[model samples]
Target: MKKISIQGIKGSFHEDAARKYFGEDVEIVECRTFRKVCELLDRDEVDGAVMAIENSIAGSLLANYALLQDFHLHVVGEIYLHIQMNLMVYPGVKFEDIQEIHSHPIALRQCSEYIDQHFGEIELQEKSDTAGAAQELAREKYKDVAAIGNQRSAEIYGLEVLERGVETNKKNYTRFFVLSKHNNPIAGTNKASISFQCGHYYGALAKVLTIFGDNKINLTKIQSIPIVGKPNEYSFHVDLEYDTEDNYERAIHLVLKNVSSLAIMGEYKKGDIELNKP
Candidate 1:
């Protein structure tokens, strides 16, 4: 069984993404932090790591991008998990009995509208993990507390669902990358993630982008990360997709001539977008 490292414990969205990508039988190694997940994979302690790269609503995880660069991990695969935040409480606890709600900050933010509408004046506390909050409420038998997480959390931690699908947006999804130590070519690779730094000159960035456009390569996503210790210098991380590999290669070749520190992060088949349901 291949062991994969994921941030947070069992029943968390990270676990959901891992199971979705690696199958249910894949062994899971839980880590409290994204850095730890990358460290375990970097040290060869696990076969792979599942780390969230971006969310539809919350934007990019900037620090995780730095971790990807610092650890030198390659993206071997990717998965898009539809987030289904729920309100869970200890068994037999009524919704009105809840005084404070706890969950990961991101989860809370996703459900902000739902929370504000129903939990006016109620104390809210941010926890390290969404499922961790649910687990705590279940394990400690906290009758006055409720947690916002997924339906899987209620099942894994033996809690009761007070409300299901509590997120403000029903279409919330998080994109996760499967990282590996080696950059092995994957079959049917139609998408790629790369990072590069352009020369500090006029239209340097535009020139690289033009190369892709001229080669018939589609630029799906582009994000700029500030270079450390450099006041205004930045590195560009981009995701590109193409109908043919030849076009992609030619674009990269031209892009290489225009950019510095060019790194091909990964080339893998794009994951299909599917909504996860309870």
Candidate 2:
């Protein structure tokens, strides 16, 4: 069985993403932080790591991007998890009996509208992990404390879900990146993630982007992050998808001519958000 590292314990969203991308039979090595996932991959503690890179509502995980660069890990695959936050409590604990609510900061923010409309006065506490809060409440037999997590957490922790889909938006999604020591290429590869530093001159960034258009590569996402220890200079990370491998190769060939530091982070198939629910 292949072992994969994740940012949170069992029943967390990262585990769900891992199972979804790598199959349900894979072993999960839970880590306390995202950087720990990188360390596990670097130290050969696991075969690969599943990490949340971006959320529809919360935006990008900037520090994780830096970790990928620092660790020299390759993005091998991607998973789009539909994050369905829930309100779970100990068995037989009714909704009205709840006195306090706990969850990770991101989960709390995602369900802010629901909490404000129903239980605004409830004392909200942010925990390090969403499923950890549920596990704690169940283990302690806290009848008055509720946790906001996922259905998997409720089942794993022996808690009862009092409310389902507590998120403000029904279309909540998080993009997870599968990282490893080396690239694991799948058949029909057409998408890629690349990072580079462009000359800090007029049209340098535009020239690289124009090359993609000229070569028929579709730019999916682009982000700029500050280069540590170098003020005012930034590195650009981009995700590009192409219909043909030839077009992608031509674009990268042209792109490298215009950038100072270029790295092909990964070349893999694009994962769509519309996959059927399991």
- Provide the lDDT at 9 for model 1: 97
Tens digit per residue, CA lDDT, model 1, 133-169: 9889888999999999987789999999888889988
Evaluate all candidate structures by whole-model CA lDDT and list the values in order: 0.91, 0.89
Question: In model 2, where do residues sit more than 4 Å from their true spots?
Answer: 275-278
User: Which candidate has the highest lDDT of all?
Assistant: 1
Clashes of 2: 0
CA shift of 248, model 2, Å: 0.7
Residues 134-172, model 2: lDDT tens digits: 889988999899999999899999999888889898888
Look at candidate 1 and give me any clashing residue pairs: none
TM-score of each: 0.96, 0.96
**Candidate 1 segments whose C-alpha is farther than 4 A from its true place:** none
